[model samples]
Target: MKATKITAIDFFDDLSSPYARKRFFVGFIVFGGLCIVAMYLDHQFVPNGAIKAVLDSVLANLLSSILVILGFYILYTFFIGPNDGLKEVVPTRARDISEAMKQLPEKTRSYLFWGRSGSYFRSSPLIVLDGYARRSKIMTNVDVLMPDPFDERLINSYRDIKDSLGEESDGNPLLANVLATTICCAVLNANNRYLSVRVFYSAFLPAFRVDLSDNGSILTQDDKSKGALFFKPSSEFHELLRTSILNEMAVSREINLEEATFKKKKLDSGSCTPEILARFGVAEAARSALAPKIATLIEERRHRYT
Candidate 1:
């Protein structure tokens, strides 16, 4: 015979059902104890006279109020179900990424991310990969799709979207951030045999960012004020998003992380010449200014991972 494990959820589930005799008895006992306390207080605090009668009446009223409140709570919890008064005016799939991740299965082994730049990946989605790598024994594959730096039209689209959102950058930081991310992925994939990271540069720019896993997907945008949207496997758009991202990644230019030359000096230099960036899969059109600042951003935070 197998042993059964008892959990608080089991008790709560029982309490919510119609045959909640144990919970009802517990409530009754609590009510009785409060009545005893009320009676004792009424006797001790008042003299034996009309004043005592008034005291008894006051205590009775207090006890009655408590009983009514308790009864209503029990009835509401057991019969009426949880109230949605605190719910959001306009509901979202999940509150944030952490909450969304919790809904995914532990066995998920693939992740596909499509976005304009590496900033979002560097900030948030990288942590998910690390976390999954720590516990999973099976091989995990990740595919990242972003616009090709050399494609002026796609790059301009990226800049226009950022400018519209008041995040005006000539795409230098984005390119540097992508390089730093590529370096980090190189090191991560090398160290962990089970993790495979593939980064692709495409000639297209997506309107929104989509992160797809085996069981669910998360949609986000550059503007942080507009929160993320989550989709379950059953959602019609979930499969559509997955197919679109996969299709884009298939034809995009993939960077050879292991073969790519990652020179600390070149990245940290004040200016990145066209030749230097082209060697490491960055577009020739990418601006050279802010290489030192980007190097500092990578070294101070993401360098440790590398």
Candidate 2:
């Protein structure tokens, strides 16, 4: 089916519920109040003149130090946090992806699966395509889709690809070639008609690449590059796959699938007044409103494609 346009609201509505919004707002208010109190204390406690100046300097330094420490802590929590623990967020998605891969055929399975490295900001999606050029045994391409800019770890990872192949030292030829190939593939594979992946970064910045063509042909020129063969699945396909995987996983754990489905329904309803008081949470009313429209779009695409 043709992919439907996903608005910012649709994505946020699906991902977050009213309870999540309440929690976020409460946290915001508390933090904001604390910051206001801190500002008041700074003004009230300082005597004025040189004494106030010294005190301001000290307070500034203290705040800066705290901010720096907090930044590092959040970074660590996102990246190198424990994977096998309940506290881990990204690992849960990784585990789900791994489980989903097992349900597909061996050859096709690799095409749909990839593991995330410990570096969160530097992490990218990995997929093994059917055909892509390869100097060594690895025929996969990495697509860096992180919302943030590329960091040192990612650059180093690209560099390390050369060392990975022990004897095939073409003096960093693979690094340069891979970078160019990835950029070319990413540009050709972009979803938007007007914007190619090359636009992801400025001319001065580094860009990521993925294997787009069937069987890696880095240098071939054509109207439709072979790289365009890396299929982009429709949203319906993704939604159905996600739902099936979640249901299967729940069943394997001996959990009552009905309760999970009910929870999702409640969330979709916008948590105003759940059927059961105890289950009240934020709802995604917008999703339900959009469902019929999405269904129609899917049906039209299916008819056209078939």
Best by TM-score: 1
Report every candidate's CA lDDT.
0.61, 0.30
Q: Which stretch of 10 consecutive residues in model 1 shows the poorest summed lDDT?
A: 1-10
Highest-lDDT candidate: 1
Candidate 1 lDDT over residue span 43-91, tens digit each: 8876799988986887687778767866776676778663222211111
**Please, what are the lDDT tens digits per residue for candidate 2 over residues 159-226?**
45435534233332222222222222332233222222221221111222222222111111111112
Error of 1 at 298 (Å): 3.2
lDDT of 2 at 164: 56
Write down the worst ten-residue block by lDDT for model 2. Answer: 114-123
